[model samples]
Target chain A: MAISVDYVVRETATNLRRNLLMTTAAILTVAVSLSLVGAALLLRQGVTRATLQWQGGVELSIFLNPDIAATQRDAIKTQLDAMPEVRRVAYVDQEAAYAEFKQMFANSPDMVESVSAKDLPPSFRVVPRQPELTEIVGQRFNKREGVKEVVYAEDMVETLINFTDFLQNVIFAVAGVLLLSAALLILNTIRMAIFARRREVAVMKLVGATNWFIRVPFMLEGMVQGLVGAAASFLMLVVSRGLIASALEGNHLIEQFVVSSADVMGTGLFILAMGALVGGAGSALAVSRFLDV
Target chain B: MTATRPAPTERDHWRRQLLLTLVAVAGGIVSLRLMALSVARERDVYLVIMADGSRVRSASYLVTLWPAAVALAAAFGVFASLVVHTYRVARFTFRSDIEPSPTGELP
Candidate 1:
């Protein structure tokens, strides 16, 4: 028997309205799940951006002994600069190093009085081809004759990266579980709805309704629910982002870690598409089990 | 043929079993998260560097809300599964009560 497309659409609309609460629950579940996933992505992006910025400013400092001869210092500088990883090397003399220190602590007369040109360590300020190689370059320079100490900002960089990585892993794990819960909730909701309408479905089957005719309406309803959920989740994300920005505006740490608008929009769209796919598939599976027309 | 009704004792027993399971699961999850957090707090390292370059070290770790979220998800999953299982059992019992007996017998 032939089924009318108009009838299917009307039936789907009626069912959607009749089970408004269930539909709403399904939509909200999807929205919350997607929002979590979206937030995780945004956080990962922020971490990547901050890491890049920090990497760009990384430098290696190679300190020298005051007794090192000028000719020996020149030779060491030449050797350091010749390395493939070395981008540029500037030799800082005792007087120049002292002057720079004095200028930095100009406001503190006590600090300036305690240190003189002779007391200040003259060194070679080394820039690397890659920020990550700063530590390696510093260690190599320290091992060379006439080199007293090496400071490559290794601890700070490692701490930041490890912290971000740990946070990102936690976010991913949480998001994964939330998404699984949403999927299970959606499947169960649809199953219950189908069970409630079993008699109506039996009557339709007796009337010669085809499987596709019955399934299309439920799929459409699921798609509508998913799209609405996505829209709500996106709005929530935008509001939360705004609130966080305002709260952290004056905070030095977070000022450099703001999520960009473009990333938010892109993530929102991706989540919306994902929600639709999951919802539609979940509903189809539920309907297929009981409505085997 | 008349349908057979479930005994009151059987119904009561099922409900009690479900309730116990829910409580046990919830308590177990709470205890697990608490243990993890307590262990983590003890090993945490906190360092304070003064303006004069002097450093002080104490116990601290960058604890955030992420762990709580994971614990919540696990709890939710346990609750959801319990609910689904209870519903299925109830539905089967209800269906059995309504269906005519194949032997044409009543109890």
Candidate 2:
């Protein structure tokens, strides 16, 4: 028997309307889980932006004794410049160091007044050819003659990054659990639909209705649930975009701590796609099982 | 040795399983793309030059890492989903003898 599109549409509608509570539960679960996913994506971007600024602040700093001989400073500079691991080396003379000190403590006039050009140490700001080799290379000059101490300025950023990684993992875990719940909810809704319409389904099968005929409407139901949940999540993200930007007002000079409109929309698109695929897949599986055509 | 032909019910089960597997693979690919985009952001290098001649650079692995790892992960996701779906289909008790019932819609 040729099943009309109208019949299928009506059946799907009836199935959805009949199971209002179950459908709502499924949708809300999907929305919550997807919202977490959206939040996680935004968090990652915020961390990336903030880290970029932190990373821009310093690489490896080698401070010299404030009273080090000019010859000693030059020797250290020359040695650093020649190393194959070193990408570039720049010397920070006393006057330049003083200027930076003033800028860094610009808010505190008393602090700036207490230190002078002579008190600040001349240093070499070294960029490594390979980032991974930074610690090992910095470790080389720990107790050397002219060097007072080598500072891995990026350590502060590294700690924050590790924290961000841990946080993202936690968010993903929560989202994973919610996603599983959403899947089970979808499965239950479909099963209930099958149970509710078993009489009609049996009559349709007896009248030679193919499995595809019985299955299409149910698969459509699953897709709709996934999509609506995803759409709800997409809207949530859209509404909440730039939350971090506002929260972190007037931050680092790099100003890269932004979650652009594109990021939200892109993540929204992903949630939508996932909703459709997972939504249909679950119902398809459930429908096929009970179809028995 | 004479091989026995598979029953029609078994063939129908295979058809349904194939459809579900296709859906799983599609879901896997989409998820993988999102993950790759996230990992690839690490390639951007942020640079800062102070009032002094000293320069600071971030994300040093900009040139030599991450992309390969992301690609490997994508490959793994694709293969894993297919294998997992196959396992589920083989082991699950989705028999055709169950009662005729059909409901449509996700969620």
In terms of TM-score, the best-performing candidate is: 1
Error of 2 at A25 (Å): 3.9
Q: Which portions of model 1 show Cα errors greater than 4 Å? A: A1-8, A62-72, A76-123, A128-155, A206-210, B1-107
Estimate, for each residue in B19-77, the C-alpha lDDT of model 1 and write its tens digit.
Answer: 53445335333523432343344224333222233433342233533443444455455
Tens-digit per-residue lDDT, A1-293, candidate 1? 56578876897799789999888877877776677667756765765776576667567777777788888788988788689998988988778876776665666678668666777677788889888778778777677777777766444345445644554454455455445545656665665677677667667776788887778888888877777888888887788778877987886545556688888899899888878887888788767766643
| Model 2 docking category | incorrect
Candidate 1, clashing residue pairs?
A: B44-B60
lDDT against the true structure, per candidate, is 0.64, 0.63
Candidate 2, TM-score vs. the true structure?
0.56
DockQ of each: 0.05, 0.04
Q: Cα deviation in Å at residue A54, candidate 1?
A: 3.1
Compared with the true structure, model 1 gives a TM-score of: 0.61
Best by lDDT: 1
Clashing pairs in 2: A217-B104, A218-B103, A218-B104, A218-B105, A221-B104, A221-B105, A221-B106, A222-B105, A222-B106, A225-B106
